[model samples]
Target chain A: MKKDEVPQDDANVLEGKLKTLKYATNEDGSYVQVQTVGWEPENLALSQAWEDIHERLEIIAQDIAAGKSSPILYFMEKCLMEPPMLAKHMGIGTWRVKRHFKAKGFAKLSQKRLEKYAYVFEVPVEHLTQFDPTRTS
Target chain B: MTNKFNHRQSAHCENGVVSNLLYHEGIDLSEPMIFGIGSGLFFSYIPFVKLNGNPGTSFRIYPGYIYKRATNRLGIKTKMRTFRNAEKAMDALDANLEKGIPTGVQTSVYYLPYLPSQYRFHFNAHNIVIYGKDGEEYLVSDPVMDDVTRIKRSDLMRARYAKGVLAPSGKMYYPINVAKDFDLKPAIIRGIQHTAKDMLTIPVPMFGIKGIYKLAKDVRKWPEKVGERKAGLHLGNLVRMQEEIGTGGGGFRFIYAAFLKEAAVIMDMPELNEIADGFTKVGDRWREFAIMASKIFKQRTNVQGDYQLAADIIVDCADQEKVLFTKLRNLKFPA
Candidate 1:
């Protein structure tokens, strides 16, 4: 069958045939899922996800409260991207990007890095530092 | 926050002194002066009043007179010199207030850029009070409304003052004064540090199962509820982190994802199985997008890489459920 022509019954049958599967989709039109025999355990795992995120986020929050610089800087440096490129990749706005660098006392470095990364990202310089990265995702 | 609280208390003490001095000595203070002591910021004349006969409407009176009057009434003597900065200004004011009196003076001073108005920024006033000194650093009581706060001169130097209020035309107000020989430095400093610690340590339990259930209720309706929760969590984290880090940066994404996830889950209503199926399909795609975005962010920002690693270990421990969280938002809540 063509990509969108698969019968609903056939799709359901195929999904049921897979003993341990929960199908999902991808941007490229591919299917993905999680399948496991122990439904209860899986459900519990899903429930605990928020706590996991909170725990990790708390450390960063603490570091922030202690007057430490944002860990994003270290992460970007490690990733080999200039600060602006990293900011762009993260979907932060230009104004906010500048403010972050300024607040961290690294405006000069941030500005320089933005120019360097603009070429590598192959997008407009403006696009590299657009308003919100998360929106696109 | 501690500094802010202590400053407020000290201000109250100063206000009492001013009130007592006025009642007992029959010293007539300008309305702005009284308001200054009341609100911890200077007030402008409201056209009906005149100062120095200039038909003066809107002017900030110098705070020195209030300090001098209070000290003189209390029979305290200390050297006074005008300083260029708020810190020096506070020290001179405090010292003069504490002079021969066995008890040191507690006073809070605030600077406002312009007269308060409906259109003006709500919190344009910045306050500081001197309760004592420690070693080389003067201990300050900050009118932050939290609790007693003491801060080092060094820390205060780094802290931002009300920019507009510090300007030439900004009104300066002094609301509190004290005449007690109590050294409150240690307490104030302890308070500030404690507040910082508390903010950092506060826990935020994500209601994941409830969030998911809400999402499963209706996708179209999910955004608002999820947005509200996400905004709350994000703001909480931001405030705490700003205290810890001294500044917040590039963390809005975490909030955004939480909001989106909540919306996605809500869209997957069980009643609309067909729509729910489509939503699940789209949800997977959204999850993949979130993961890709997160990876890109990690590659670019490198924020909390170690923490991310730890989270990865936990994800592994939980048998790596293929929920959108681990891959996308990097946060997981209890189901």
Candidate 2:
């Protein structure tokens, strides 16, 4: 039966039941269900536009989990230049970038934020900075 | 200068020849030599045995100021160690008036055996006395250097042979007069406790950030009023933020998301045509869940004395919505 043809109450019930069964499985078992949710037409069409933009972000996270992110070298290159240009290129606000650097103990030029910055550049959807939208550039 | 060396060398050397040779060199030769022994304090020393036998020995070394009195007398204190080669030992002993037994006390030069090959000979051997005119050089009775040689400050610094002198092998011994009071147990306990507390407090934000990101992804398609394009952008931004900031809220994801939500509400472009009503309900639910998680987090911090409970709240919320959000996004909404 098509998802839209199904009654709203029935869909809600199925969703709740599937959810219960879904979370019951362990981490490995949940992957199929996770993908299935994204594949459903009632959901996919509504979120497709944004999903494309987020694909890079998902890939970056997967890279981080897989240990491919290099936070050190990136920050090293960043340090040899002005903070503003680096922030702009990275699509984050300068203050936010600075805060991240501070928290990660990269206060010195030798320190790098390769992994963290990789994740940032990879995901382009969020507001990477603290710039007030109302403020004119 | 002559009197002090004569007193320390009298027990180890009896020959007048070595003593005469040192007097010719312009070295002061009298000051008691002091050497910093590394692991020497652990092996043949008294404190090391005490500390190993009773774990509380650390208290004396690091007593809290408030409990100084109670811990001060817990262990013996000793003067630092020094050495003299055979040449200096003979000369100083020969110049002394008091024969047989001297006025100053002579302590053993204790060292370790497993030291790097360069130091093996000095390991646990009685090689020298604390005498020499220059005060920095050791007149050695060394079996390794042979024929009562003189070793300079540079040689001693590079000598990795004496374990007791170089490393604290958990032992210490010295003249009775040089002993002091110390306790070792409480100090060790305090160190362990401080480290444990630090580990517990610093990782909560990372967990919260990841949890919220996952929550946003699950509810991305639920808000139809925000339109597909806008909702997608919001989710994309969230994913981006998670990658950049480490999805660990560092305790700030909620505030940031709230602002983004406001932007969505104000823009009102109506891109979510097919599933507008369903999307609104899901958006409301997502907001409610986030607030609930935040409340639980704050309460856990206040009552439980840790962020574990708060992190668990996030994990639980994520677990609950994982399937629903995925399905919502994948399914086609009726126009």
Candidate 3:
């Protein structure tokens, strides 16, 4: 892209503070580094990704409210982890992790296991057990 | 904290880190030059490997390879280590900092608190340079950031040990020695030659120019195979991979073009200037594909026809890249 033509669309993804470098051609036809705040397509893609994440979180919240699943499921989604990956981090069986997704299974959890979940999610023990989905994360 | 340790931001993190670190050692190399010498331009589409529930489409070589390859090609001795214990890793990094050695660290973006909130995700391969430690905070020069930032020691540890795919596991590396007066001609030629070989001669269908074609085919089938929403998410992923912050625009195409331009002048081959321009045009084609894909993803246009158009643009990129790499493969560098 020509240096003059580099897009500075003021993409909100950068939050108007961060600027990223882009390589563009100068008037002399030589490439020079140019700083861009944002680009339209990139911002769109970023928002779309976050939208998907929020939608997934919303579904998990509903499941938690319905007592079909526990707050562990909500926190798991918040951490952007799948069951297998979270289990690997926890150093436990994937089946055990899946079982904890249930409200009944979570309530029967030992204090040690709850602490593990809280630590993995970077939340406090109380937050893990007393999660209120109505509160914005 | 280190005397005159200047941090220069570049388009991609690894290239920026490599270039900035070399410059600190009195070896001045541009980001594109390091990128070219490292053979960083690459394409890969792994269907079975999912990132954020979308099929993985990577525009460059895997993390850490660029620094490894570029330094090796330049005959620069370096040391790299990954630790099983976080305390040991921090201690090693602290020791290196005390010696005034700027270390390249691989960390996940999610744990980097300085980044814009929107930019933070579970990406585990983001590269940064920690030049000094001030009290409990580490001074960081993240390549994609416009300015230097500081991270607390605890946060830095979390970032370095971020879990999930491509976990960094506290990886740190730095050049231990640099030979005086090494020639760039041989490194440049070898770099170009290796990239040509990788792009044109790779046998795997999921890699090289073939990967572009494979992605094109998949794009055409995404709407039918998956539902519209899922397909749109997939296309959004393609856009994100291509135009995202670290790519230096056009998924590293512009950077590659700049490399070709520099090589043309250094090698005294005037024809490479034209090829650089050709590659720039190819980069624009990639951008066009991104625009069309985004439109379809947003449903701003007719989804069916636009998918075909998007696929055609990708196919065009594949064809152009095939021709360009072939030309590069056949080029005779003066001995």
Consecutive 10-residue window with the lowest summed lDDT within model 3 chain B: B297-306
- Candidate number achieving the greatest lDDT relative to the actual structure: 3
Error of 1 at B163 (Å): 6.6
Range of the 10 consecutive residues with the lowest summed lDDT in candidate 1 chain A: A6-15
lDDT at B228, model 1: 32
lDDT of 2 at B147: 34
Tens digit of lDDT per residue, candidate 2, span A16-128? 21211010112221101111111122222223322343454455444434545322223322222234534643556777555544324333323134444544233221212
Q: lDDT by residue for model 2 over B118-169, one digit each (tens)? A: 1122122232332332465544332211134444543443231223222212
The DockQ-derived docking category for candidate 1 is incorrect
Ranking by TM-score: 3, 1, 2
| Model 2 regions lying over 4 Å from their true place | A1-137, B1-127, B143-147, B160-335
Lowest summed lDDT across 10 adjacent residues in model 2 chain B is found at B34-43
Q: Against the true structure, what is every candidate's RMSD? A: 25.9, 30.8, 1.4
Ranking by lDDT: 3, 1, 2
The local lDDT score (0 to 100) that residue B256 gets in candidate 1 is 20
Candidate 2 chain B TM? 0.18
**Leading candidate by TM-score:** 3
Q: Model 1, retained fraction of real contacts?
A: 0.00
- lDDT tens digits by residue: candidate 1, B1-335: 11111122211223333433333233433221232222221112222222211112111123344445434444334343333565664455445335411112322122111211111121222334444455545444332222333455543432322222222222223323434552222222222222223222223211222222222232223224344333223222212211111000011111122223332333332222232233234333323322332342223332333223423432331222223222322322223
